[model samples]
Target chain A: MTAVLALLEFAPGTGATTGFRLVDPAQPHLTVTDLAATRGDGIFETARVVDGRVQALEAHLERLAQSARMLELPAPTLPLWRDAINAVAVALAAAGVADGSIKFVLTRGIEGGQVPTGWVLGLPSPDFTRERAEGIRIVLLDRGYRHDVAHTSPWLLAGAKTLSYAVNRAVLREAARRGADDALFVSSDGYLLEGAVSSLLLRVGSRLVTPRVDIGILAGTTQADVFNWAELQGFTTGYELLTPGDLATADAAWLVSSVRHAAPVRAVDGVERPIDAELTARINAALDGRID
Target chain B: MTAVLALLEFAPGTGATTGFRLVDPAQPHLTVTDLAATRGDGIFETARVVDGRVQALEAHLERLAQSARMLELPAPTLPLWRDAINAVAVALAAAGVADGSIKFVLTRGIEGGQVPTGWVLGLPSPDFTRERAEGIRIVLLDRGYRHDVAHTSPWLLAGAKTLSYAVNRAVLREAARRGADDALFVSSDGYLLEGAVSSLLLRVGSRLVTPRVDIGILAGTTQADVFNWAELQGFTTGYELLTPGDLATADAAWLVSSVRHAAPVRAVDGVERPIDAELTARINAALDGRID
Candidate 1:
């Protein structure tokens, strides 16, 4: 079993992850010149691997398929992608990772005949000392994405995990530039959107609320899970349009995602608030994990 | 020289371009995985190569460098890129391509350390046949790009040719969907923007007009050249804001770029028009032998 475990682990120089072959560890050969890179025409997803198994694997697969459908690209066969994702998870588990992260992606294949070349990438998980339910700091930035684009903008991947993330990365960079850890995108008309890469939730006194899907916010898998768990815990939940000021005035705030789980918000626009231990307790209880 | 050219024409399997050393072209490769595939974080330019030289080489390089700067990625050293472009042109010319198109690109390098990776890519000239300047059919679509974003949107490449071209491709696809060969993006407010892949130009009687730089249009190098030559030929030239109705009503319209040179707009929204022989004559005369 130990030898088998050693075989599965992907070291820096070994070059292979799971059964899916890797070209090289340093610089693998890839058909990158295709339309995917050239045109931003693809979709991707990240999954958490724990104890040699992928968490919420079905949800990630559904999202990947849905995103491809939205992009009008052919969706990858689920069995093949599942096999690939499992292999990476098993490999990481064999390498002494009791828990880690696995990233799965389906992209439009190389630029040629018709379909896009999809890819599945896996990486090691981060080391989390403990869940910091204490909260996080957020800055609001305008992405100028129109609200009505929920159904109109053909390129509105705002609700889907499309491969065109240059702007999302830029949003985070802008937040970092302003000395904030994360950014919450506000529409040009002042309505609150989602965070740079996470879904936003605010605690207005007793009821927890987030933007509705009609507002073009991504239907976050982790956010959904947290919402369900919150309901079970007897916490009231609602979806509503919000402004940045609404978040600033909230008694509790959290950014929810697969990797981050539930990250509580401590401040907005330089205004700090007391850490809501009760809210953190509820979120962590819902996530069944610690926020790293 | 043909033998030298043979060395430059890389087989698709080889993934090597004439000027650069592409040792690997598979996944996990620094050049492929980090820069080309993952983040969609790169920039590129497409221009024509004539004889043994790249057309408007300096202008393309300027745009490439500017895009790199806007993306916060390092610009490829101009001398190295210049040498690369030249070598590729030589190879193409040697391959019997007296007139052809060339694509030059730079991307964020491979992902490592703190920042994402960057890469540079080059491809052979496209096959373009010299036509009798019969115009193309154009359709107007809203691109959701604001006018002031021409200078205001920092994360946006604006006029810079960044890798996030999904919107551009979408416009072209929309045009094709509507049975047109190309499209001219109209602002939500109905002001004519640029073409999906070319600069917009109109001939209102004797005067040749294109959108001004303030209109959030790419300041086209070929259009500038045409304007300069048109001025030399005593043809009136001006820049103005054009509406979709105005474009449809123009005496003549054309899409200008390095590759297309000066393709005429034969129709807009199914409304047919006669090609302006005088305008075509002036464009051909202006562009003749200037590229090489």
Candidate 2:
């Protein structure tokens, strides 16, 4: 089997979790009326799994709950999700898949239906060895929102990692059209934001910096783990409101995600930039080591 | 059956239409990895059907093609779509449904797979007598983008009717929380944008106006029909850059959509506003009259 699928059932009215059922990942599971399929009305979290353990498990669950709160979906049951996640990770490990990802999604359910649809799907992670080794070429695109949109307009659903990622996909395609590997979104008002599917991390000498979490971006779980690991390695870490100038001046930069770990940004908008190859390899080693 | 579903199959490489298969709408037809469900990476067009004819069908198809161009999806074979759409509309009409909607969707297929996924679904329209006659209360929400985003950053997918509607759903929830029926969005730069799922039409005395299509809003098919019909009735029509202050001063206003037609705005942010009951009824009657 290439993937494992678990579906969650919710109790009526109280938003309490009833139970979960593991289903065939190959077969059809979602109806057309599912809000996730129709309106992109859902929240999701992807956690990397290694050696039968889900890395950054708590952080992923916490972020999922935070996203659920933002989208006003039923709050996810943490223990239930953690157990289901572990079950999927265990399945992957049993299949001899050393590295994979478990993506858990909680949608507002069928249109007008009372029950919400929740699922955890585990799939072997594709090899990102090249991206992690040689690094990635990136371009900065406008995110079409101000940096403070999360606070100024909560209804915009900024900072909430919802499934409405069409713009995110568009940016990646745009980057490809521009002959780049990935795209880092810059706010419309000239502040550095995050990547389409990852968080922007910068290294200046021994100090590591990432955009402030309060900005309109996801609080990246993997980035958080990298920061923790870097701190233990005698490096300082911080959250700051960064700009393109800061990124250009940094000693090294990366677009970090759970499955991909740390991918150094080797170029910006076709212009070659310095990459910390040794540090990137170390970060990936630490991520694969399952420090949690 | 409550709904009709037609799944479209495309020829390899050329994006030519091979055929369409009518399927069970109740069954799961899409994979878990379809880009539409995963990333909201799709475009859709919903047209109202009356007496076996889809209103503004050509306009909807053109807009769908336009959206496909913007999103870089396979250009929908227009005639195939027309036939499929008509077939679904005919199915609805044969089922004794006089009033209904045909929503056609074209998605980028399963992740990384070639050939797109296309579907046409026809469902009975909900009763909107209260919203049309009694009118709806509305609140203005910030859309989190400047009015010029479509031109400045086309990758934001602003003008395209993409499946990424989480924010659209969020704004409505916010409106309901504020004791309103609908939400109209304003650009972050203080210019008027469109509504969450409808187009805003205003009447400044003898003039009918809507926000310019170039200002990152959909070129509303229903509003276009309304304008053409109003011109026949000797009302001058135009597109202009507008603001909340302009909305405040308009003699009458409406939130018009494919399914609901023209719904007058009776209140704004809990404050009662003037609604042209006579004009609203006439407009709705004209719409139902199948002016096309």
User: Which regions of candidate 1 deviate over 4 angstroms?
Assistant: A1-25, A127-134, A156-158, A288-292, B1-32, B114-132, B150-152
Across residues B1-292, which tens digit of lDDT does each residue of candidate 2 receive?
4788898989877766778978899898877777777888899998999978999999999999999999999889999999999999888899899899998998888776787888899999999999999999999999988998999999999999998999999999999999999999999889888888899999999999999999999999999999989999999999999999999999999999999999999998888998999999889988888734
Q: List candidate 2 stretches off by more than 4 Å.
A: none
Report the number of the highest-lDDT candidate: 2
Complex DockQ per candidate: 0.38, 0.84
Per-residue C-alpha lDDT of model 1 across residues A233-265, encoded as one tens digit per residue: 777888888887787788878888776677877
The sequence of per-residue lDDT tens digits that candidate 2 reaches over residues A69-151 is 99888889899988888998998889898888899988887777877888898999999999999999999999988999999
Q: Which candidate's DockQ is highest? A: 2
Give a tens-digit lDDT track for model 1, residues B1-292. 1222111122233223334443333333333345445567777777776686777889888877777776776545666677767866776677687766666655555555333333333344444344435567888776665666655556545676666666676667667888888888776556888887789888887788998777666778788888988888777998887787777788888888887778888888887887886668668666756854
Q: Interface RMSD for every prediction, one decimal?
A: 3.3, 0.9
lDDT of 2 at A153: 92
